[model samples]
Target: MSFQDEFNSGVLEVISPSPAYYPDTSRLRITLGDPPERVRWRSKQNLDFAYLMMYSQPKAVFYDQLDDILAKPHFITTMKIAAYDRIANKQSRFVLDFCQLGFIGKMFRCVELPWLVQLFFMFYSDKPVDRLLENEIHTKVSLLATDDAACRRAKDELWVHYKPSLFQHIGTQPSLKEKLKKSGNAEHPSDRFYNTTVEVLLKIVPLSEASENMTSDGYVIIGKFDSRCIAEGVVSQKLGAFSELRLTVHSVSDNRAILSEIFIWGQEAR
Candidate 1:
């Protein structure tokens, strides 16, 4: 079944905890107002904010362990959740980050505590906008402490990530004011995505005379004869090392072929 279908049928569960609320149905209490300029630097701290998308088996989390962490006064609860989940399940979780549109060439993968770090930055960081710089520092430090705790439990390798991101933010508008100011370049098209096909160009060049007449099986066929030394073709099948390319050079005066270069083009190749 599709992931969404499974999620709706209770075959899957996504535990996305918010920073604004506690397990006891009470809002987290924190100072409210603008943050001081000195404390603003702390906001730039690098935190793993890529754990929003994770898949796990049912009952992976031990409620007892989760409760133990939640009972503490930590601001980054998502990290704690991930830590205990690993402890109980004894297995790694796959996390994916949203791929920005128009950035297909720059796709990458890394292990990260996805939703855990962003929770503080997205929800709680702005709540105490007017708090003293010291309070802000304390809050930021508390977030880091929880992150450290989670990392200690969930090793760096425990988090596996998929490449050519499968997820992307739905809309073009940015949710945060800082991002909104740069919204013009914030949204673009993504070239790669999970389980999706992409178009690529394949070119082949003769490294030497030995490779010119190499057999390419039936994966490619000569499409055009540019010159006595140059040839172009279309890939009839997926090209690979096993697809032995054979170039039969033919001369105008003598029935001899001398291939200088070969160009191959197709919808996809490997």
Candidate 2:
């Protein structure tokens, strides 16, 4: 979809789902059936600020605080857009045509980008006329610049990017040119992407089996035992944070039996 359409729909869904309510006593109690087109245009300009933020490298601390920034009453004004345009024109397009296919191999390490831009290339292209211009411009940089310095300069002049990318490319297959038959290794994954998996390891032992001495409490038992002789089993279950795992132990006969040990190990989930 066009950026304008996407922006309008998103605003309708998120910012103004219905006519906003105001206090009866307030001076601004008047309500309109629909916001004027100019108001929508101003909102779109504010959204352009979001794109500008994503393109430019802001302080690492503010990477995850974009929502808070956008919540401000006057975050992006028309004056700021005009000021930025005066300093750095966003209208210019940098097109670099590759005449030699062999030159592509040597250009691999020429440009290093944030994970988000890398992800755009993995699943999108400029072949289709309807594709977003931003994607086309971003992917075009690698072809336009021959060295790291040139690429870095282009990025500084174009848009902002955040460090430790918020999203990762996890697909094991390519989506581009899917109509053509292709084979061989197709995995393309981002190395710098943040790891979101939360793992937890739990160990349970009978009250009698647990060490009475505080010094020896560090030791844990992790070994195998015959189920016939000793009732032992491992259950691999997914659980959420602060969830409880209850274990019930019973003896084959009426006689009392002690549950020796239970061990579970995995990274703590976040």
Candidate 3:
């Protein structure tokens, strides 16, 4: 399997012995482990455009439109429902299917929007989730990102926009509840699949500290760090020494912040 190794906030640089291994992409491919064991993966793109193109011209248009919406720092309701469905379903045979798309989208995002996008679902069946759904989904994604407390304004909005359905599902899955309690939690494929998304914002998004005093107010406050180097070092070491990492960040009244929590997302006792 291929995987991207992030170190020191910048892209992990490895010298490939052969040019064949180094494709046109900026990423470097490396083989790790004794006896020549290795993993091949790329983080440049997360969707599959080729497969998407096979659908129809309308599908392609929706795909482009959805990309526009997702490129926004926040959700765009004008996004086609079908586009959301493909992503929610992991619509690719493998990664790198959307390599070019991710490359283009990153440029658009930097120039235009900054907040993550949200798609509204119809409550029950026919009723569309209110605008509050955006807030609620944001809070939930924030919680999964492991951010808590720390934002007074967002905190207030969270309570005003709380949803009962969240609690009902929480009981059915207590472990997920526990996972939400920590920060910098290395999200699983499932976590990445569901909930709102947190794309690595800006040049790089570091793994922040985990939250300690988490609340049911629908948010997790993982701490934030200054440099990507520090973030990658912490995250890399944690994964190497442990197995998984749970990342959390706490924000003080000021825009500045500190690391409050750090949990190994997929940690297993040694």
Candidates' C-alpha lDDT: 0.31, 0.30, 0.27
Ranking by lDDT: 1, 2, 3
* Model 1 TM-score relative to the real fold: 0.21
State the local distance difference test value for candidate 1: 0.31
lDDT at residue 238 of model 1 (Cα atoms): 32
**Residue 87 deviation, candidate 2, in Å?**
5.7
State the weakest 10-residue window (summed lDDT) of model 2.
Answer: 100-109
| TM-scores vs. true structure, each candidate | 0.21, 0.22, 0.18
Better of 2 and 3 by TM-score: 2
Off by more than 4 A, model 2: 1-135, 138-146, 162-198, 201-270
- Tens digits of lDDT, candidate 3, 1-270: 543546554344333233452334333333223121111122111112222222223322332312322132222342233234545876521111111111221111111111222122111111112222334435544654444554434444332221111111112233222212322212111121112212121222223532332334423323333332133222233212322233343322222222332223322321
Ranking by TM-score: 2, 1, 3
User: What tens-digit string does per-residue lDDT give for candidate 2 at 77-175?
Assistant: 432443345447554322221111111101111122244333333322212211232444456676888898897677544543222222222222423
Q: Residue 122's C-alpha lDDT in candidate 2?
A: 37
Compute the lDDT for candidate 3. 0.27
Looking at candidate 3, the ten consecutive residues that score lowest on lDDT are: 161-170
